[model samples]
Target: MSKFEQQLNQQLHDLAKEKAPQRDLWRGIELGIEHQHDTGTVPQNRHRRLAAVAASVALVVSLSWYGIQQTSVPATDHPTGQALVKALSNQHEQQKQALLVQYTDAPAMTENWEAQLAELDEAASAIKAALKEDPNNGALLRMLQQVHQQQITLIERVHAPQWQQI
Candidate 1:
């Protein structure tokens, strides 16, 4: 079970009405029993259990909503940075999927593509390192590859007339 569940269970069990104010426990029980009695009678533990369930649901929903908000925000495009980010995203997904499966790669990919891919791979490595130091920044991580791509490609192609072909 999760920490939330564990805490809830402890709270439920530790509701000892003894030395710690009988009035409060009685009030809770009275309120619970009144609700139960008004609803034409229910089991003693039902209200307590319901309260715990509602708390758990609220906690889970809050966490899920936060996650959705985080993932739903769009990243801004920065040309080569965008391309590099796309590649990194592909790799991240592959890494996640690898936990559940295995795959094999073809033997004869091009050396030229390898060098281009390596530049991206290096940038991704640096971005990941930065991310480890600051995990809250999805944009920084996302911008990593694309930023380097623009710099590297521009330096290599700036003198050539055919850069427009890029």
Candidate 2:
């Protein structure tokens, strides 16, 4: 290497050393943040409070819904399954009425929902006839109850607002 080139390289290395800041830049950033808070432009505490209230309202609403669902069915059980029949019938009727009200003017997603509901009702009727012949038949009783539940579910699915395309 030439002496002049070596000296130039040494000078570049000396100039490449780290330069210190003349003032604390962190203090400027801290003050800017503090000014925003003081001016109420950024409500740091308000955000937390709003988030907490939303969470609390969501929790309360979910709990209330759960409680309502839990209380819908009575705990008393009839030995002959009469209470079960009564409960299923009442629930089915209520759901049917609600669906009718909701879908009286609403179009169904499926074209054959009425036929499907009719088929389920027919099955329920056949099961009910068998149940009348042998009221103690657990299998027949369960089948009838299942049919009722299916009808309710089908009605709910067809009449749900979310299912409406518009």
Could you give the C-alpha RMSD of every candidate to the true structure, in order shown? 23.2, 9.7
For 17-82, candidate 1 gives per-residue lDDT tens digits of 666654567788888978878876565468788899999999999999988986887554332344
**What is the RMSD of candidate 1?**
23.2
Measured by TM-score, how close is model 2 to the native structure? 0.45
Residue-level lDDT for 160 in candidate 1: 32
Give the number of the best model, judged by lDDT: 2
Model 1: how far residue 80 lies from native, Å? 25
TM-scores vs. true structure, each candidate = 0.26, 0.45
For each candidate, the alpha-carbon lDDT, in order, equals: 0.60, 0.79
